[model samples]
Target: MTFDKNSFSLAGKVALITGGARGIGQFYSIALSKYGADIFVVSASQKGWEDTTQKVEANGQKVAFLQQDITNPDAADDIVAAAVAEFGHLDILINNAGVQLRNDVLDFKDEDWRSVIDVNLNGLYYLSHAAAKVMAKQQHGKIINIGSMQSYRAGKRIFPYTASKHAVMGLTKAYADALAPYHIQVNGLAPGYISTEMTKPLQEDPVRGPEIAAHIPSGDWGQPEQLMGPMVFLASEASDYVTGVMLPVDGGYLLR
Candidate 1:
């Protein structure tokens, strides 16, 4: 067999990205489109998708938008069906939708804990399961679950978020092992402290911001765009042999 230089090209493919309207999800959507994949963006709301749609279209790729709360039990089926209906098939699935709540463990409410788990862990599994069926039928696909720094280490005041992220890594491995026979690759992208809307408060904190940066060997927070290369590689044929791994795009934060 010969290595194709264009293995990273997503031409003629279709990708479904959850929480794709803003933040890191937006970058993932744009990056995949730039590599020649049509995009299907699923978010909690459609209010901010216009820009994402425009950007994907600007890349000469078609895009479809869907608004649904991933926490809803039926959302997985609906999201998968909608993407397939819009594009005729689904080639890549990015489980990027997530939620985080910060509170001391003693003060954390039960509802808040459940909510975080619902969106971050349970919802991702449901969606991945639904997409896996479709990909199995086609005998090829990529599933990239969005993990976080918390996936590997515990963080103060974010117990639920940390737990959910840790579960994501496990899900990636379990799904990868089970789905390997079907030619579907299951993996994860664990991002470090990126400057996204969700993390704006921490980034703008006069003291916390610099303190966090100092810990990172890179000496700065990661920009959303920095994730583009890793996203494209995992979503495309360039990573056909890779599965069940969590690739950290953390600007060397993990090294410390």
Candidate 2:
């Protein structure tokens, strides 16, 4: 019944972001920390997280790191355990870790197909399943899955990535429904053409860059920082009534 801006703050919240060492995931880590959340970063690569950790700590937020291949079946439980041990509880889980390998469906290798699905879809389920248990018991939490524009549109090639994203939406909805009783809100953020390490090559393509930009109403590539607001909203009480929905922070690309 009362309004408080601090209700939007993540103070005392603990968040775990997979693939938090780089790209969009790295931005998620720092942005949440800036809003007063302590951060736990889980990733297969640790090379880039040292800088991310420094930024979070610089913001006066406690941060922790775990190096593990989230595709591994056991990695999810381990991540949740480490986070709970470090912070005593978790209030947010960002399933931002994903892999995209471009290949025509006809030529897509078996391993590429499996690997993309493993990291993007299977790993998400594993991690979400683990975190939901802890959160369900507590009856309060947020699970934000990093979906993609591919979830709604299929571009050329990248069949596996498209398939995985589409599947992610279903998982988001199912979890949202099942966890609603426990007060654990689940949602997805679908980013379109964000300028990040994984997307740099595509954006750099002499032909592709301008072509893609022309379609986006914003007429530019979006930065990771642009996504911070939506991330914080869904993680905070602002979106307590929003769930099982894929909010596209796409500069209107999907409309075109």
Candidate 3:
């Protein structure tokens, strides 16, 4: 086969990104759109999506916003259906919606634990399953799950978040194994500590912040835009032969 550089192009494709209203999810939405894919975003609220929509539109791609909590039992099907309805087809699914609560294990409430698992693991599975059905029919697709540094190592005061991310890696591999025959690529992007609203606490901490950065070989936290290249590669034809793997976009955090 000819090695056309345009193999990275997402022209004529549609992508569904969960938790896409802000933070890392927002970057993923805009980056994918910049490469030629129309975007469908699902978030708990639509309040702050205007900028995301504008960014995608500025890329000359259409964007659709959906206000739905992934934790809702029926939301998976509804989300997939809505994306298909908007663009008439779905080509990529990014399971970027996740939640985390930090508390000492002894003081962690059961409700908080369940909430983390619901959004991070259970909800992701439902959405991936629903999207896989659609992709299977087309016999080609990509499912990119957003994992975390916690996906590989344990972190203090975030037990549930740690557990849920670990499960995400497992699901990525399982889905890849089962869906490969249908030409669907199931993989994950495990981001290291990135500067975002969600990690503001860590960034603000005088001691913890420096300690975290010191451990990273890069000696700095990652920026959201740094993830664009990896995201596009996994979501486009460039990764046709890749599946069942977790690609770390960390600033060499894992190396240490």
Please tell me which predicted candidate would have the highest lDDT against the true structure: 3
Task: Kindly provide the TM-score of model 2 when superposed on the true structure, using C-alpha atoms.
Answer: 0.97
Clashes of each: 0, 0, 0
Residue pairs in collision within model 3: none
Question: How do the residues 17-45 of candidate 2 rate in per-residue lDDT, one tens digit apiece?
Answer: 99887888888998899999999999887
Candidate 1 off by > 4 Å: none
TM-scores of all predicted structures: 0.97, 0.97, 0.98
What does candidate 1's lDDT look like per residue over 1-256, in tens digits? 3468689899999999999878889999999999999999999887668899789999999999988998886999999999999999999999999988888878989999999999999999999999999999999999999999999999889999999999999999999999999999999999988887778989889999998899899798998899999999999898999999999989888888
- For candidate 3, lDDT tens digit of each residue in 1-256? 4558899999999999998878889899989999999999999998669999888999999999999999887999999999999999999999999888889878989999999999999999999999999999999999999998999998789999999999999999999999999999999999988998878988889998998999899698999999999999999898999999999988888888
Decide which is better by lDDT, 1 or 3: 3
Q: What C-alpha lDDT do the candidate models reach, one value each?
A: 0.93, 0.91, 0.94
Worst 10 residues of 2 by lDDT: 1-10
